[model samples]
Target: MHFSRVPVRTLDTDEKSVAQFGTEKMLESAVLLADSDLDAVVTLSEEITKATGLPCSTSTLAQVEVLKKYGVKRLSLTGPYVDGPMRGLVAFYQGLGYEVLKTSQMNERNNVVFGNTPLVRIKELIREADHPDAECIVVACTNWPAALVVQEMEAELGKPIYDSVCVTLWKALGMVGVGIPLFGWGGLLQDDPILKKMEDVLEILLTCCAASRTTLRLDFLQKNCHVDTVCAEACAAGIAQLKQILVQNDLANTDIPPPKALMDVYAVRAQMLAPLVRGDEIYGWISVHQVGKTRVWTEDEIGELREAVERVNGILRTAGWI
Candidate 1:
């Protein structure tokens, strides 16, 4: 829940320098927070696209998540970038399947000028960026002082105003299951019953993933190679398949179909395993089981298992484990 900001030592207006600075700062922040007691980190710059190998926008993926969370499809953007970086920003949003209705960029791209630009000027820019079909307006730079006026402007404009800094904060808080409804930050910061439930489910799954990883590692040390865990069972079957299930447990065979043996020992009837993957690299697998009689695996269960694995993958990325 604690935050520490480390300013990247580079001019915000210099696109190349800003990209490099963002990459370094992201790594720097991850390393710093990873060693501390903090559970997560949120990199504020949406302009830092180089590290993730994303086209155009650096923060587009995270922003897209924000958009998806709020069900916003079309966007109007106002930022302090010059023409060169501005094009990249627009392309980034377009690449993510969001319709960019209108955009306004300030002629002055100086770092100090952008950071110090008057709120009145930004209000005008927001108006210029507004469009009839746009669902939201994004103040697309972290350094630009937008948070001070976001909620107020949104009230006047009758549309959501998403400041990059606010979005980053909202996203970071959401990921950790802190759904506090803070006023003066626009609709994204408000409480959503659906999003809260989703966050609660995600937090539970993340906890399960961490506990599973820990249990597997501990069992690996205890068993001394040939880790007889749920994932190991799944790996024995096949990594390509999403899940491996043994519904009815027969306790006669303990060696073959290790999952069954493990299930038999625990008196479990059904087991399912999903691969934990980062890009194409398969780190390990995850599993779920039922202790009672045979149970049919539904499509929703399978989908949720996959989502749990992906959530674990996300945690791994944030922790620099992948």
Candidate 2:
């Protein structure tokens, strides 16, 4: 798919002194553009999400994608916005379970100044925002020329640096199942298999570990149920399975004989469950199985499964899901 830029004039020349894009107007522009030229629309501005009362940085779809991909619960944020909007941006991420360990804003309102800020200043701001508990650093504005310095900054800081524009492109490409190689942008790009796997695992988490049977029951009791019965039952079952695995910590047919009840429920002769864990904490669990015949899980297969689960834990910790 070809990439296109749809210029949104947020303000006229006379209105340039203040940021003037209302949420209704911005959504209207996005809807109009999606109708005319794109399969999907990813807004680059964080302000829109903030103004729209979204829990996270809804202004840009890329920010949400990045948070999901990394499972970032705690973050270090650096951006180019005024004090008020900057606080709103941090609060947005916080609402999604991300704890802002530190935040550094340039306090620059003019696009020209933000775009023209020196590379050294960018590095300094990121450094100021860095914290030991932060899982990743997010350079949070699309128009601040952050992509140009992302590679060097990530290397220097010894953590991933997610620039807004690069993340938008990454999500767009993935949406179309395109695996085009990209380099020097940041850890998110470079066509990294690990990053893609992390994204895949998070998708599984969102789909599989949705909610427990107890939660569904509560919803039904409160008359707040929105999910259909079939779907809700499925989610509850999947979550129950994951919780069972978490209590066991490790389970494999090769190591221990499968219980009759477990076998009956899954209808599987061979199965392995790996916990998504960091240190001593367990976030969730994932498993692989064979349906009919007994099969052995090889060393490589088990190792890969553990790695994927660990990756999920890392992302969840960073995104504040855990």
lDDT of 1: 0.58
Best by TM-score: 1
Residue pairs with backbone atoms closer than 3 Å in model 2 (clashes)? 49-59, 70-315, 71-315, 71-319, 72-318, 72-319, 72-320, 73-318, 73-319, 73-320
TM-score to native of every candidate shown: 0.52, 0.50
Query: Where is model 2 more than 4 Å wrong at Cα?
Result: 1-19, 27-37, 44-59, 194-322
| TM-score of decoy 1 | 0.52
Over 1-322, each residue of candidate 2 has an lDDT whose tens digit, in order, gives: 4333434333123444334555555665554454454444455345434443322223266677777877888889988777776787788888878888999988776766777888888888889889988889888876778888887777567678888878877876665566644545766776444335454654444343321211110012122222221101112232332112312212343456666655566455555565544457543345454444565556665555556566655654574445
Worst 10 residues of 1 by lDDT: 234-243
Model 1 per-residue lDDT tens digits across residues 1-322: 5544555434444566667555566655555544554544565343323333222222444677778877998999889877767787888888888889999989665666778999998888999999989999988887789888886677577778888888877767666767645544566775444324434444454344321111111122212212232222111111121114222233243234644444545545445555554567544555554443455666665666667555655654564445
- lDDT of candidates 1 onward, in order: 0.58, 0.57
Error of 1 at 178 (Å): 0.7
* Model 1 ranges with Cα > 4 A deviation: 1-19, 22-25, 44-59, 194-322
